[model samples]
Target: MKKGLIRTMLSAVLGLACAFAFAGEVQVAVAANFTAPVQAIAADFEKDTGNKVVASYGATGQFYAQIKNGAPFEVFLAADDTTPAKLETEGMTVPGSRFTYATGALALWSAKDGYVDANGDVLKKNGFTHLAIANPKAAPYGLAATQALDKLGLTQAVSSKIVEGQNISQAQQFVATGNAELGFVALSQIYRNGKITSGSAWIVPASLHEPIKQDAVILQKGKDNPVAKQFTDYLKGPKAAAVIKSFGYQL
Candidate 1:
């Protein structure tokens, strides 16, 4: 019995050792708006699969520039589907590895309660001196914010008081830190579980702007990295879907 027990123990230890030895890492560039939920998911991914996810967060447009310049990113989780589709057309992505991983929602948010009405009437009121928005030239959410403003005929009225952040995360930080009285941000940033988790927000209606369809793709550099493919597959599975939905993303 003692010898049998020793043999089983040795086999288990060897199995674990082999798992660690072969475990690989994937370097991912994630959209800034997805920072919170991705971080949470990555932790679970690491624990469950024994593979490592090294993530960098920023505007999707900026990540595109870096990828084109040969940044060593294995996977990309972009803020919009167009950017990933563009990369595929350019032959920079692994064919048949592209998919829409999430669809995001935008919101007008403020650090103070009652600052933004549910109907988003605060923009017309124009009570605040400064309003924060991401750089429309580089962030998809920023472009959506402008589109919403145009639909409401408030672009011209609020243009003078606008402050730009290089990315969505920074735009949200401006509002969070009182640098701007209010800002347009991803609903996931301030909401969860059918409620707003922070100050105040008005979830922008989809009719006000284009759908924020976010996509994921494995870049050419990652085509040979098995872990990259694993990570993307993981994103499609139920566990990752739960995290995405919890963060207010429409799968």
Candidate 2:
């Protein structure tokens, strides 16, 4: 029985070796907010499939522009599905390759303790002089923040109090450096190392705004790439899902 078990294990190892021998490299363009989780997933995927994954993280709009201009990206993981679906419609993405992987949540956070209330009623208090948000025209987090404010009836009232950043990372930097007292940031930014650290935050309820459903797709550039297809499949697997959930994002 022990000999049979050893033979089975060796056969499995050989099968894995053969799989790796046929795998190549994949280049991915991922959204900034999903960076941490995607990096973790990439490592696991490479180990499992013996394929190297090169990933770049940036705003969805920026990536969309890049892809339209013929960026050499094999896969796209967007913060919003609109861009991916648009790519599909434009014949830039492989039809049927698009899938929703996660939903993003917005949070109001401050680097200073007690600067933000748990319920986020502080926004109505007018105690803060500046509130940071990403550029609503370009970033999904910014759009969500704008929607939240509108839902709370604070959009017009707080317009003068707002500081706009180019992207979610910039908005986070604005709050971190005290350029803004409180900022709307992606939940992944504040909740790092397996927990929330910096300051208080109120996770905006999903009902308060439009759903930020993140989508992933194989780009036209990688249409025939074996490595890209393998990575895309690995991303849809359980290990990647766990890594995504660990980053304080809903998968």
Candidate 3:
């Protein structure tokens, strides 16, 4: 009777151990501008699959530095394609795992009504006293904003009133809290909860800037993790695509 009871306990322990080993979580390094859509998509992904996602959001430049210094991120959702491509070439990311996840749009926004023109003509008139923009060297959205200024011939004229943010999120906050009269920000922020918010915004035309093709890739640290692949596949599906689009991102 004693031997039989010991066998039963051992079997139960082994069974629990196996279950724990099979349950996996994938760690994702996300860009700041993608915060809302990615969070929504991650929730849907967790529902569809048992796997869980742990995401960290920051500037692409910061993520790039961390990845290069051997950060343990399983996947990188970059604000632009360049960093992921570089990582793949450097053998830090899994080959053939890179793809464009979303296309971001740059917008001039103000929390107040009528601060932005429907056609974006306010840019030419220098209508606002202060305009916030991200750091062009670090954030893709900032680069796009700079490009828009150049395209509209407003770069030199508007340089003085420009206040710089380290990332797109900060740029949005500057405008949202009235720190700056208006600012360049990600279009995603304007469309929260599946609806456009109170702020008036003008989506910068694609013709005025280079396409912000956001990309993602599985990193070397998570190359063999089943959860990483599962999460990546989930982001490409219809449900996740719908969530991404609702945030003003183009899939």
Which candidate leads in lDDT? 1
Deviation from native of the Cα of residue 15 in model 3, angstroms? 12
Higher TM-score: candidate 1 or 3? Answer: 1
Candidate 1 lDDT over residue span 1-251, tens digit each: 99999999999999998998888899999999999988988998998889999999999999999999999998999999999999999999999999999999999999999889989989898989999999988899999999999999999999999999999999999999999999999998998878899899999999999999999999999999999999999999999999999989898
RMSD to the hidden true structure, all candidates: 1.1, 3.3, 4.7
Residue 16 lDDT (model 2):
87
Task: Compare the candidates by TM-score and give the number of the best one.
Answer: 1
- TM-score, cand. 1 vs. native: 0.97
lDDT of all predictions: 0.95, 0.88, 0.88
Candidates ranked, most accurate by lDDT first: 1, 3, 2
Q: List candidate 1 stretches off by more than 4 Å.
A: none
Clashes of 2: 0
The TM-score between candidate 3 and the true structure equals: 0.89
Error of 1 at 132 (Å): 0.6
Task: Show where candidate 2 strays beyond 4 Å.
Answer: 1-23, 192-194
Kindly list the per-residue Cα lDDT of model 2 for residues 16-119, writing each as its tens digit. 88987787898999888887778788888878778898998888898899999989998999989898999999999888999998988899999998878879
Candidate 3 per-residue lDDT over residues 177-213, each given as its tens digit: 9999899899997876555587788888899999999
